[model samples]
Target chain A: MVKVTYVAHDGTRTELEGDPGDSVMSLAIANGLDGIVGECGGSMMCATCHCYVDDDWQAATGARMDGEEDMLESAVCEVTGRSRLSCQITLSEALDGLVVHLPEEQV
Target chain B: MSAGRVVIIGAGQGGLQAAMSLRQEGHSGPITLIGGEPGLPYQRPALSKAFLKTGEADKLALRPESFFATKDITLRTGEWVDAIDREAGVVRVGAEALPFDHLILATGTRNLRPAIPGIDRALDLRTLDDAAALRAALDRPRKVAVIGGGFIGLEFAAVAAGLGHEVSVAEAAPRLMARAVSPEMSRRFRELHEALGTALHLANGVTEVTETGLTLADGTEIAGDLVLLAAGVRPNTELAEAAGLEIANGIAVDAELRTRDPRIFALGDCAAFPEPGSGRRIRLESVQAATDHARAIARTIGTGTATPYAAVPWFWSDQSNLKLQIAGLADPTDDSVTLEDGAVLRFRDGRLTAVETINNAKIHMKARRLLAAAPVPTRDSLLQRNYDLTAA
Candidate 1:
């Protein structure tokens, strides 16, 4: 199990063990992390699963897939140098302790 | 003799909701819900996702078998509505005729089976049974060819590809979901599908749909074991047309969702109600629209005078982890601004046409309320609050 840390919009942080091969969004949703609606379920069709991958983990996380990158265009929070959709990022053994910053809303 | 009965044709999402609303609004008249498909009414949105995984048909039912009995709502499944006798105010189902005080056509839309060769081999995802059939086909490993890069096609493609099936989407349009989304959004989904190992072909038209493969307009045959038709949908307006009610792209209805005949009201995918925003009649196939239309129709039946159906249009699509949400309707001509946070807001001239959001439910919901509110939001109010449209 990979250690996943989610930083809430209000600065509260929660950490959970994310199953390998499962997406960060699914993990967040599974753990009942607020602000992540995951309305489209896990489909990239909606961008409600936005999260900024913590800077420390950006180097570990590779480039965003075209679908994931394109979907980030509609996210609410600034997808600055570290923005990424949690649904698009699947956890692996390589991503042991990944940190993702939660966005303000996931409609 | 007594109050007239309201017979709703096509017991889909909209039809079922209309029946419930009619009953909820305290309409004492008889309610008969008829459906062409067998089994209880079920939600179609999950037909592409959860149902595909579980293959549990029982869970898909919108209302249990006992729902009809408890609600005093007559449900006739496995029977096709043959015609609508406007004069008699009744719908003919084979040898039987169900009379109605008011006819509500909720026949919804059907998948457009394109004119192609080998069409018999392809499967559909419109109905619950169709999704079950496709789920069965998924048990084995094979290449799936999806026709029409619309929502269903792309959605199924995402699921199939995620499940490790090789998938391909052939779209005749220049971009995927071109009619529904902005160019930027289209490009995003296209890229996402590509990265997921699903092959996408745009600007390519299909001339023939074969069981083993598909023949493109350019005479290119794409090999496949199964061809799924996600080719969009056309409103089921044949019954209304035969009845001599006005038929535009869909069954034409005035502001009150009443067809030419004042006694007939329509909603959901079948009826083309005057667009709340554009005022140029449009038909939508979303749960929100169907539910809202049912509520609006209920208000009329309950009180007296009916108000126009004016509900903010919002949509959501799940594609392999990316949840795309749209708070408003944006046309091709609408101008789009990419905010600092990457949220794409569409504007028609000066007014906000729509808000395209991915993973940002706060903005999406806020935008919906803002658009639906009495006072339209200006650019400053939206931009001032750090691009938060919900900010007053």
Candidate 2:
């Protein structure tokens, strides 16, 4: 199991354990985590699962693909250098203790 | 009063959503979802995208089979709805007739095949089986000829090209995605496809689909191992038409998404509802439109709230690395102004009609919220702000 921490916009952090191969967006949805609406069900067609990776874990998350980068540009919240779409990030054992910040709105 | 029985036809996105939303809206009525296709309803949009790359049909299911049983929703799969017996308030599937107090028609659309000789030789990319066949065809490197340059055609073309297969898109329209996107945006996509090594044959209609390839209207022969027919779609309006429902391009529905027969309603690609603000009836084929329409209809049926369906329409297309997103609707003749950030703002009669963006989700979401505002921003105001939507 990989432990993932989702930090809401209000600075509230919720830690959850997910099996490998489960996408961050799917994990959040499964746990009923607020602020992440996987409207397109991880298709990457919708940008409703936008999140900001913790600065310390940026390198661990790897680089965003062109498709994901394009999708992040459409996120409702402010997209900075750390912005990423949670659907594109698959949970893995190496990603244990990964921390991501949830945006205020996904739309 | 007891919640009446709700019957839904065509278990696509809209049909399934209607059943789920009805229950969410506190409707305790018997809900029966009849689908012509086998298995639980899956996401159709992925058939042309991820399903092509992964070839995983199981991931496409919107809900697990157990969810239906748990929700007490009766799901009838592999059963084609033959006719609607309005007088008896029942839908006929062969000899079986299921009674319903209220009906929701979400029959969806079928691929529109052009009148080309040997067109049957071409494969489609609409259903799960079609996608599986397409994925199998992509196993070996071979030339692929796409008959249309629309979203599905381009998406498949991009995927096929990315897999190192030679691809050529033949579009009858002078420009790519002529009906849905602006000319500038179309040109951008044309370049994107060309850069990916896919050939673009604009304004070239297929006259014949030979076993080996296709022949264009101008007598141009394109050789390919496989041909994909993604030209367009025709709404499944035959069911509604036979039932004596108003059909204008699609089954005509009022602002509240109700058909002329008060007990029945239509939504999604098969229903032509009046466009907000303009009042001109338009048929939109998008997941957002279908889901929102279902929610609105469910509210009316469950809570007695006949709130007019007025959600802003949005759509997206993924081709190669480019993600083109459009918020709100735009007429083909709408005037467009390109912003400094590469987003296109479309306007009709000085009113903002749509915003087209390539990989820009922030602006797209803002455009949706702006369009849905009580006093919509004007084109002049947008121009004055140099297309800064936030300023408007």
Candidate 3:
């Protein structure tokens, strides 16, 4: 199992396990975490799954995908350099300790 | 309505979102989500788009079973709601009478069965079971005839074509997606499917659905092994209508999403509320509108504070490699102005209506923000800024 920690805007932390092929957004949604709406069901049609990778884990998680930046423009909160759509991030053994912070709102 | 027992009829996206949002808003009352479909509530958007290719049913689930159990949400699946007793404030489900302090009608829409002979021969693609059957039928290379040129039909056609099947789309309108998109966009998509070897029979309505395929209104017969009925959908307003609730295009609701009866609210594809800016009654069949309406309804019931549902309407369609996104609402007669970037700006009576883009998500997002702003950008104002949504 891959361990992922989701930090909400209010600083609440949630740790969950996911399969190697599962996405962070799907993990948050399946576990019913308050943050990360995943409104588009990881289709990247909606940016409700926007999240910020913990700075230390940025390099391990890699950069955004081809069309992720454009989709992020529709996110309800402020977009940051570390911002990435959680749906685009697939879990793996190397990134077992993936840590992501959720924005204040995702509508 | 604060902290009252909430009963939602329809466990689709909107219904599930209402239960979640109610809990998020700190509602402590018992929440019952009744769905006619068997199993946990899942999203319907991907049924025609991705599920046809992947067949990953687990991925479509909006929430896990554990989430419902932990949230104390009573999810009754495969249960048909018989009727709504407005005077009694209870809904009849078989022999049980489930009472509710507040009832949310999110019945959604159903596929429109046109009055064509042998229509039963054509398979539907609305539900997961329907998609599963269609996907199974596509296990072998088969000639496919899709009756409709709208989003669902085109999407299924694209997937079937990509899978090496002989596909043809017959649309009754002169142009594809005529009701939802502008002429230029319909042209672009026509060119796209044509390039993919999918024959498009525009302005041709299916006169009959035969075992071999479909016969068009123009007396042309398209031979195919598989026939898909994707003509369109009609709002599921029978229950609302039978209950004596006022219904226009759909179950009529106010700006606050409440039906004539204060304790009941209708929303999502099943309900038609006044358009935010124009006050024109309209019904949208998108996940955005459904979930957004659910949130607004939740706010009113969960917190005892009513707020008008004025979220900017947006939609997207994935056909082949192109992503057609529309930011706002546009009438069939809205004027279309194509920009150099290929994004079409729709206007009516000199006021900007909707922004349509193909494979351009940035401009689509910006257009949504612009449309949501007060004093909506005018066509002349947009022209001065070179049609750049960020400038306005």
User: lDDT of all predictions, in order shown?
Assistant: 0.80, 0.89, 0.92
**Which window of ten consecutive residues has the lowest lDDT sum in model 2 chain B?**
B58-67
Sorting all predicted structures by lDDT, with the top scorer first, yields 3, 2, 1
Residue-by-residue lDDT tens digits, candidate 1, B24-49: 66777888999888888777888887
Fnat per model, in the order given?
0.03, 0.12, 0.72
User: Every model's DockQ, to 2 decimals?
Assistant: 0.05, 0.20, 0.73
Name the candidate, 2 or 3, with the larger DockQ value.
Answer: 3
**For residues B1-392, what per-residue lDDT tens digits would candidate 2 score against the true structure?**
23899999989989988987798778998999999889988888888888899886766777767778877899998999999999999999999899999999999999998888998989998889899999999999989999999999999999999999999989999999999999999999999999999988999899999978989988888988899999999999998999999999989999999999988999899999999888999999999888889989998999877869999999999889888989999988999998877799999889999999988776887798899987778887877887898666
- For model 3, the superposed segments whose C-alpha errors exceed 4 Å read none
Model 1 residue B135 CA deviation in Å: 0.9
Instruction: Give the lDDT of residue B259 in candidate 2.
Output: 95
Q: Write down the TM-score of every candidate.
A: 0.77, 0.88, 0.98
Chain A TM per candidate, in order of listing: 0.92, 0.96, 0.98
After superposing candidate 2, which stretches have Cα over 4 Å from the reference? A1-19, A27-37, A43-89, A94-107
Sorted into a CAPRI-style docking class, model 1 comes out as incorrect
The alpha-carbon deviation from the true structure for residue B375 of candidate 2, after best TM-score superposition, in angstroms, is 2.7
- Model 3 chain A weakest lDDT span, ten residues long: A27-36
